[model samples]
Target: MKTFYWLVKRELWEHRGGFFWAPIITGGIFLLLNIMGIITAEVLGASHGIQIGASGALTQVIAEMDSGDMSKVGILLDVAMYAAMGLLIVVLGFVVFFYCLGALYDDRRDRSILFWKSLPISDASTVLSKVVSATVLAPAIAVVVGIIVGMLQLLILAITLSFHGVNVWQLLVLAHPFKVMFNLIGYIPLYVLWALPSVGWLLLCSAWARNKPFLWAVALPVATGLLISWFGIMGLFHLPTRWFWTNIVQRSLFSVFPGTGSLFGGTPHNAPHIDGLHALDLNTTYQLLGSPDLWIGVVAGAALLAGAIWFRRWRDDS
Candidate 1:
């Protein structure tokens, strides 16, 4: 158990840039851009002699807005937070994709596997540690950072509203940031499942490819997809080419992307104004467990991951 912990820690130690700093840097840039945007708007408005603070028309809009309208405002805030998080998850996908692509290959290329092979650790432990790092730790860090960035963004929004004489406390109460945070955190486990296929595929390529693992990882699925499409067009075997592209090729390559898990099934259906805008519907999102595709992908991923471990155990040639 302790060895396993250390293995994961080692993975983190080596890949801290992808697992931690990528998302942190992304969130920082996002906040900075938003702040600059607000400042620009304020300066432009001031130059135009358009004062927003306590304007009678603006006050009238606030005064006339009912609970429903206020909830819409809250949804807007939720969307902002969701957008920020979406960016982090996008970074997570790319990070995990390349991280797994190189996890085993790098050791072989640098001849560091010789040292690790002298250790008591098994290849399975090392490979599984990378999996856990990609699916669990990376997402956890991104979510925590995203939540912090989100709360700060909300604070910025509230201040902006205050400057315009709009009371934002009610919107804050309705926004349910804590609920949203919990929702993002809760998605991590399911994300692990949804992500396994992509992770497994990448790791398998990493462990098996002697050179240019990235090229192999990318070309295999894409080439197969192209062949399937061409044959289908030529009236071969009546294969569902479109379905194959979407479900197989795409999932194998891109399922590590967050929200793509259930393909936006997490969106809150209760938000009528936005017609299914941001936020997690735990009930609906959890329903993916009932999906055969999810489990089928899981089985395939486990098999690919097993293959990765096998290759890592024996194939050390760079």
Candidate 2:
């Protein structure tokens, strides 16, 4: 158990730049842009009575909260928080994609796999460590960094609003930082489950490809789809080549919240009308967890992961 833990830790240590620093840097850039926008808004508002768009909306929401109805304010901030998280998720997803693509291949390319294999560890453990790092540890790190960066950004916004005579406490009341953080944390497990198939597939390619794992990871699927389309085999099978690509993309992107409508699916016409701070509902989470697609993907991912381990054990990179 301790060895497994250390293996996972080693993966994190090696890929800290991608799994850790990338999100932090991206969040820092977002924070800087937000601060600069606030400053610009203050200057413009002072000279021309023009309101900063985001702050103006927030200020209005805060004003409405004085009337004893704080729900709208909370909902607005919740949506904003989700928007920020969505951006961070996109960045994290890309990092994990490339990280998995190269996880096994890089060791062999640099002849480090020889040293790793000489250790008293099995290939399964080594591959599992990379999988856990990409799917679980990497996302966890990104989420924590994102939450911290979010809190800091909101704190700055609150202070800036207070300077303009907007009540900052009202903003905090609406923010519901604890609730937001909890929901974001809850998303981590769902994301791991949702993204497993893609991650496992990448790991398989990483272990199996003799060279250019990225090309194998990306090109093979695309080429297969293209060949099927060109040969009209897809038409005969009643499965369009586009469906193959679309399904993979949707599975990769939308598996996080299964019952909830996806960004790819377009907003549902019957979407719930939330009038208050959107706390993570246990019922909705239960429904998402019960999804058949989620289970199917998990099974597929497990098969691919098994293939990866087997390939890594037998393939001689040197």
Candidate 3:
């Protein structure tokens, strides 16, 4: 148990810089935006107050002139804000993915896997620790950073509203900030499950490939699938081609987890190459379990994991 924790800790310590800098940068940007929004709103509202008060006719004309336009402006603002947030979150996910890949790949490239294998730890523990680092620890750290940034942004917004003579406490409470937080909590688990296959493949690729694991991992399967399909179309090795087409039911290992969207299911994102592909539904899940494709991923995952262990175990340490 301690060994597992130590392994995970060591890996995190090595790569903490990448994970730690994102929230700080994102939060700073969010804070700046919130402050600017508050200042702009206050200035605009104050500038228009005298004109609005002096003539009801002028006020009505001003409202009429911009009523529809205001909504469009608001929508644009919302899109921009969400886009920024989404970009931050996406970067966080990317950092986590690449960090895990780097960690796994680095050890192999540097011949450090053998050093760990010589320890008392089992292969399962070593691999599992990296999985924990990628799936759980990384996300946990990112979310905490997000929450802190979010709270700081809210505080700045509130202060700005107060200065502008608007009470925003009810708005804040009604927004159910805590409920919003809980919803995010629910999303993290799903995200982890969604990310698992990529994480696993990253480790396996690290273990197996001597160089450029990313390129080969993607290119090899795609090349194999295409060749098989071409052969099937040509009526050469028809059965082999048919089996290859059928068994690639899911392109990503993440698809094997229950409740992944149709994007990863049965076909590669509904591309034109695979004709007669059905949208993945609950039925597709059951069908996948019964199908040869799921079994192949299962067997392949097991074999890769076993091979990673053996590679670590028997590889030259000197």
Candidate 4:
């Protein structure tokens, strides 16, 4: 267990630039842009001899807002929080994609695999450590960083509004920070389940491909998808085209993205909510977990991961 912990830490140390700094840098960029935008708005408003609350209309609007209106503001801020995190999650897809695509092959290319192979560590432990780092630790970092960035975003808004005398504390008070954190962080386990196939598939290519694992990982599934569509195989087999596209192609390629439980095909259009603004909140996730399709992907991803482990042990052209 101690060794496994260190193995995961090693992966973190090596990939911290991607898993940590990428989101922080992205947040920083957006923060800078947002600040610039606010300054521009203030400058323009000043030129017009009218600021946000100069006419007293904005202040009166907030003062007149009832509980229902305040709740609406809270919902809007929750949405802003989601938007902040959504940007980071998109970066995560690209990060984990390339990370898995090179996780094993890079070590071999640099001859570091030989050094590791000299140790007591098994290939299974090594591969599984990468898996845990990609699935759990990566998303956890995104959620935490997203929360921080989201709060800062709100702070900017509050400060901007404060300069205009519009009861800025209400803006901060209406936001549901605890709920936002819960929802963003809560999605990680479900993301792990949804991401298994893509992670496993990319890692398998990383282990098996002699070079250009990215090409192999991308081309294989896409070629298969094209072949199915070109031959009209699904029509002959009485299966919807979407079934293969979603299950076979997307599971192979895009399962790394969150909210992919929709591919599982068990949740209703009107599924219940579990205290999050996202369509794929806990309630919807619970429903998707019951789908046999999801479990089948889980099994396939595990098998692919096992193949990755096996290949890493023997395939060493690099």
Candidates 1 and 2: which is better by TM-score?
A: 1
Better of 2 and 4 by lDDT: 4
On a 0 to 100 scale, what is the lDDT of residue 170 in model 2?
66
Residue 260 lDDT in candidate 3: 42
Give each model a TM-score: 0.92, 0.86, 0.65, 0.94
Backbone clash count for every predicted candidate, in the order shown? 0, 0, 0, 0
Global lDDT of each candidate: 0.85, 0.74, 0.56, 0.85
Off by over 4 Å in 1: 233-237, 264-274
Model 3, span 1-318: residue lDDT tens: 888889989877887776677756876777787678766866797787733223445334434655566545343433333334454566676676576456556877776766766788887778777767776776667666666666666656555545544444633443334543454454555445445555556667665667787776567666777976765653654456656543442334333222342344333334344222122123332343444444555556555566655654555533
User: How would you encode candidate 4's per-residue C-alpha lDDT over 1-318 as one tens digit per residue?
Assistant: 999999999998999999999999988887888899999989998998876786778989988989999899998887877778888888988888899998999988888888889999999999999999999998888889999999999988888888787777868889988878887777788778778988999999999998899899989888988888888889988997777888888888888876656644556557554454656455555677777777788899999999999998888574
Which portions of model 2 miss their true places by more than 4 Å?
Answer: 49-69, 248-286
Question: On residues 1-318, what C-alpha lDDT tens digit does candidate 2 reach at each position?
Answer: 899999999988888898889988988888888889888878888799765534667567655555446765666666656656666787887888888888989998999899999999999998998888887888788778878887887788778867766778766777676777887787667767767788788889999999998888778777776786688776776987777666664554334332222333333346565333342543344344555666777888889899999999999758
**Least accurate stretch of 10 residues (summed lDDT) in model 3?**
274-283
Judge candidate 2 at residue 83 and give its lDDT. 56
**TM-score order of candidates, top first:** 4, 1, 2, 3
Which candidate model has the greater TM-score, 2 or 3?
2
